[model samples]
Target: MPLADWLDRRTGWRSLAARARADLSRPVPRHVNALFALGTVAGTFLAVQVATGVLLLFHYRASADAAHGSLEALLSEVPSGWFVRSLHAWGAHLFVATLLLHMARVFVYGGYKRPRELTWILGSVLLLLGLGFAFTGSVLPWDQRAYWATTVGTRMAEAAPLVGEELLRLVRGGEEVGEATLGRMFALHVAVLPLALLPVLGAHLWLVRRLGVSTLEDADVEERVGHARLCEGGEPFFPHHVLQEAFVANLALGLLFLLAILAPAGLGPRADPLETPPGVRPEWYFLPVYQLQKYMPRSLLGIEGNTLGFLASIPPVLLLLALPFLDRSPARAPSRRKGAMALGLLVLGLGGALGVLGYLSNRTVQAFGRTFVFDDRGFPERAAGPATEPR
Candidate 1:
């Protein structure tokens, strides 16, 4: 007689609802502590991104000719547009950060074992998709900073072995970034990547539901170390764990709001093909790879150094994706899994250090008839003046 009964009679909506409730109420692993709530926090930011992104679409012009103008008007004229834009911008940063933390947590706990291999792989793919979003979004603004940053990023793809030039052509829609490029990027950003990402996201969540939360005890960590340190069994996913996740999600949203208000996203000058910024770099997430490329020798064993550096970056990523296969040991404890722990720490620390170096690389100085630019990976060159304009 009721709406629920009507829907249930017509479309079996009640059964689907029952299934969802069952999934939500399933017991999570006891070892999943407060830190595990980060995945939920990241998920919350993703929802924010989608919501604000849709709002942005109403006013955004996906052409290089008008994209920058559209953005400027959005910030300056549209009602609450700045807030929506800022939320989308800042939400992206938080989404990527939270996902990185979540992945690190999973890695440290050895959660990517036999049955969970696909889960880890899906998460890794999602991280890559996040970067894809970053790449496509960077160009959408059509501002000087966005344009140059995209230029640097696309050029790096040219280091790929055989299909290098073709990859460049494919991404930029021609030889250079222009209207065609913007059109292609817009399609990818608004249509392609999101279409790909949502299905992958759905599958990842389904895998999580199917596999159940991995336990440190399953990996023999609790057995090696006394059982006192680990939780004996998990609480329900409903009230207890869901409440903690909700708290984390709310905190993340509140922080995002404050950041949007205090430090709103900025738009630089319009894109100019003739003018190149003195030192252009990719986003922070891509900086480690950029720094690595910069540090590599011009020629390596008679091969192009950029190519070698590009190749060098692949193995670590491959190893990350192939971790379940590489580390067959069942031990999950930090003390028990020394090799895995060291490797993980090395990768994490190196990435963090390189990111810091990249951020600090904007400094420039002149001494002894030579100009030194930290952004060029500490290279010194003889120049008429400083690399950047004088203040």
Candidate 2:
């Protein structure tokens, strides 16, 4: 048989299987839940970011010397380029925000327990990967601000005690940022990270299928047993939920395109290798981590260490990774899991507090005339001089 004919023959069977599975796994609740809606919203934004990123790649140039100028030209010259870039930028933020919200909902609702633990763990990895995507993409603009901000970022990494120097060298591809660094970052941002995420994401969805969607405690599962009983049986995945997902996805795509057309991204001047810019900051997603680095004591246990900084970051990282295991209660309702509920609130409170303190530290440093300002070449223009001329 011709391939087309074979595919056509299989379509009906495929649809039937999908419908059967959906009917079996559908929520027992009569009303659609808000958590379900929120996940859909987040999934929509993720699709937008992926699509826009691909479009932007068509116009992006990777060379450090030309990358910044090319981005500027794309904004000014390409038709509707500004809107596309802005949508891409804003979409990134939206994606992170929505994912965070989704995770919170899952945590509070006891969605991470027992059979669903793997799903939650995979989702956490996805969150970290999303963050990596954001950080790598941020530096591609190659503006003075972007360059020096990344410099400070890498230095913070290098501050790790024993292994820090090696790790920094691996990230930078050398002692300093240059073409190699840009190329490596771009590769990781576009190629490596995506490749790494794909299998994990597939596994996550598979687990969702195997374990099934979580439900509020009040819903009875026995009611959702039959296939043909429309009122009692779950809706068909194809015409019901799948169609809804499609509609939401297309709506998100439309909005992203509209944004891209209305306001393309703007680019700063080309990064000069010789100078640095003042008040350089990272993308908003990194604000918490960046802030944490500031408040952590320079040393711990009198060991004389930046090791403390490295160690300080470990808890949050581990907590995020270990959430699936940490939340092992049998209860699946937010109200029932008091310990998890309290922990979630504590994490949020700490994050907010640390962010505020970090911001205050920056302000204090600037007030004391100790903050490093950068020149156009992305090098720090030192504030404290040799104190030589007075003699």
lDDT, each prediction: 0.85, 0.71
Candidate 1 has its poorest 10 consecutive residues by lDDT at: 378-387
Tens-place lDDT digits, model 2, residues 97-185:
87888888787777777667778889999989988888888888898877877787777778777778898888888888778888988
Candidate 1: segments with Cα more than 4 A from true spot: 220-233, 364-375, 378-391
RMSD of 1: 4.3
Clashing pairs in 1: none
Please give the lDDT score for candidate 2: 0.71
- Tell me how many residue pairs clash in candidate 1: 0
Q: For model 1, how does the per-residue alpha-carbon lDDT over 112-222 read when each residue is reduced to its tens digit? A: 875688999999999999988978888899999889898888888899888889999998889998898889888988899999998899999998777667777655553
Model 1 accuracy (lDDT, Cα): 0.85
- Candidates in order, TM-scores: namely 0.90, 0.80
